[model samples]
Target: MSSTTLVIGGTGKTGRKVVQQLRALGEPVRIGSRRNSPPFDWENPATWPAALAGIDRLYVSFQPDLAVPGAAKAISDLTYLAVAGGVRKVVLLSGKGEQEAERCERIVADSGIPYTILRASWFSQNFSESFLMEPILSGTVALPKPEAPIPYVDTGDIAEVAVQSLLDDRHDGRIYELTGPRQLTFPEVVEEIAAATRRYIRYVPVPLEEYVEGLRNHDLPPDYVWLIGYLFGEVLGKPGNEDVSGDIERVLGRPARDFSDYVRETADSGIWNRVPSSS
Candidate 1:
C-alpha cells in the first residue's frame, strides 16, 4: 500500500517538482499549501495537524527560507507533531553553508523519525525563475559576489533526490550535499545566459551593502532584504562554497545537471527571450 505523503511547500519551486514526481510514481500525494483543502500554513500551527492527519511521510520545504529567524523552532515544532502524528519518514530541503538552516537540520535529525537532509548549494533556476530573472530581463545583472564560484544545482535534481529519500529507506539518516558538476562565477553565469539567449546581458559587481540597499529601495520586505544579504555574505562569501559534490550522481547514478544545460533548456523555453512588458 502506498503511504500518503504531505509536501509542505507543495506549490513552491522544489515542492511542486517533488509532488509531480511522486504522483507520476503512483504514490499518494497531499499538497500542504494555504490554498489546498485542509490547508497547511507555516504561520498557522493550527492548520498543521489536519494536514498531517493521514500523512505517513513528509517533504519539508520551509517558506521564504530555513535560514530565517524562528525557522529552527518551526522545524522543531513540526517534527514533534509529525512524530506524534505517525509520520514514518521525513525529507528536509536545506541550504548549504547556512548556519541558521543547520539549526533546523539538527532538530529534524534528533526527531527520532527516519530522515534525509539535502543541503543544496544554490538553484540554477534562480537566473530564469527567481529574483535574478528581473535583472536578466533588464539586461543588467548587478549584484555582489560577482567572483563567487557557485555550483548551482538544478531543482529537478533536488526533487528527484528528495523523492528517492522519501521512498527509499537506504537514504534515511543520510545527509547529501547536492551541487552541480561545475562551478561558475556570477559573470560567467550571465555570459552563459547571454550566449544561450543571444541577448546582451551585462554583469556588474557591487558591494554587498549597496545591493541590499537597492533591494530596500525597491520596497522589498525587510526580511527578504536581510536574507539576500545573509545569503551573499555568509554563504557565497564563505570559502569553499564553490566546491562541487558528487552526491547527486552517487544517488541517481547520473551526473548532476550542469548550469550550461539549465541555461540552454531555459533559453529554449523562451522565458529569457520574452521582452519585459512595460507596465
Candidate 2:
C-alpha cells in the first residue's frame, strides 16, 4: 500500500493548491483538517497521531502564522511526531524575515527527517482572499505603512514548490526564499488593482493603534488582533523584507509571476467587483 501524503491545513491558501497539484499527479493524499475523516487541529495533540498515521510525507502550513507565540514548539512537536510515525519527508511553508518563523524552520531542519523550507514573502492573494479583501471591496485599502513595498509572492508558486519538495528529495535540506518578481507598496498595489478593475480604489494610511481598535470593533479575538498587528507593525513596518528573490525561478525553472499579471488575472475573475449582498 502506498503511504498517504498528509497535507496539514489542506483547505487553506497554499495547502489547497498543493493538495490539488498532488491529486492531479495521482498521489495518495489525506487532507489534514478539522473536517477530515481524522480531523487534525493544531491546538489538539490527540488529533496528531491519527493524522500522522500511515503518512509517508507531510506538508506543514501553520495557521495564523509561525510567528505567533508557541508556534515553534507546536511545529517541533508535530515534526517529532511525524518522524516517529514513519514519515520520511516534510515540506514547511514559512515566513521570510521573521525570527519565530526561522525558529520553526530550525525545528523542521533538525527533525532528522528530510525537509524543505520555503520562506515565502507575503502572499498576493491577501488582497482578494483574505482580510484585505473587505477593504478592497470597500474601495479603500487602509494600512499602517503605504510606502513599505513587499515582494508579495503568489500562493500558486508556493504550492508548486511545495509539491516538488514533497515528492523530490533533491529539494531536501534546501531553503528557498520565494518572492515575486518585484516589490510593490500598498499604494502601488491598490493602483494596480484599480487599473485592472477600472475602479477608483483609494489607499488610506491608518495608525497601527487605530487599526487594532478597528479590529476589536469587529469583535475579532485578541490573538487575531495581535497577529494582524504584528504582521503589519513588526513585519511590514520594518525594513529588509522587500527584496526580490530568484529562488522561485531557480526551483520552478520559470520567472515568478508579476503583481500586474496577478491583478489582471484576479480582476478578470470578477472577484474585485463582487457586491456584498444586503443583509
Candidate 3:
C-alpha cells in the first residue's frame, strides 16, 4: 500500500520537486501550501489538524524560514497536532547552520514521529530563482561580503532525499548535511555565471551595514535580512564544510550535481536574459 504524504511548501523549489517525485512514484501526495488546496499556514494553527488528517508522512519545508520568531512554538504545536492526526513520518528541509531552525528540528525529534532532517547549505537556486536572481539579472551583484564562500546545494538533491525519507523508513532519525560538490566565493560564482552566459556580470562587495541599508530601502523583511546576515556573516567562508557532502551520493547512489551543471542549466533556461545597462 502506498503512503499518503502531505507536502508542505509544495510550490517551493525543493517541495515542488518532492511533490513531482512523489506523484511520479505513485504515492498519494497532498500539497500543504497556503496557496494550494487544503491550505496549510504556519501562523494559523487551526488549519494544522485538517492537513495532518490521514497524512502518513509529511515533507516539512517551512516557508519564509524556520529561523524566524515563534517557529519553534509553531513546530511544537504542529507536532502535537500531527501526532494527534496520525502522522507517522516527517521529513524537514532545514538550513545547515541556523540556530532557530535547529530549535524546530528538536521539536520534531522529540515528537515521537519518524523524522529525517536535511540541514541544507545555501541553495544554488538563490541565483537562478531567489534574491540573487534579481541582482544577477541586473548584472550588478552587490552583497555585504565578497570573500564569503558559500557551499551552495542544489534543491534537486534536497528534494530527492526528502522523498526517500518520506517514502522509505531507512532514513528515520537521520540528519543529512547537504552541500554542493565545490565551494565558491560570491565573486567566483558571479564569474561562473558570467562564463556560462558569456555576459559581463559584475560583483560589488559592500559593507554589511550598506547591504542591510540596501535591503531596508527596498522594504525587505528584517527577518529575511537577519537570515541572510547570519548566513553570510557566520556560516560562509568556513573551511570545514567547503567540500561536497557524501550524504547525497550515499543516500541516492549518485554523485551530487555540480555547480557548473546548475549554472549551465540556468543559462540555457533563459531565466536571466535582460540586456544589462552599460552605466
Best by lDDT: 1
lDDT of 1: 0.92
Q: RMSD for each model, in Å, please?
A: 1.0, 1.4, 2.1
C-alpha local distance difference test of each model: 0.92, 0.89, 0.84
* Model 2 ranges off by over 4 Å: 277-279
Better of 2 and 3 by TM-score: 2
Better of 1 and 3 by lDDT: 1
lDDT-superior candidate, 2 or 3: 2
Estimate the overall C-alpha local distance difference test score of candidate 3. 0.84
Per-candidate clash tally: 0, 0, 0
Best by TM-score: 1
Candidate 3 lDDT by residue in tens digits, 1-279: 667889988888898999999898888999998986678997788888778878888898886778878788888888888888878898988887676688899999999999999999889998977878878988889986686667788999999989888878899999999987777889999999999988888999898877877777877788887777766666666565455678988889998888899999999998778654453
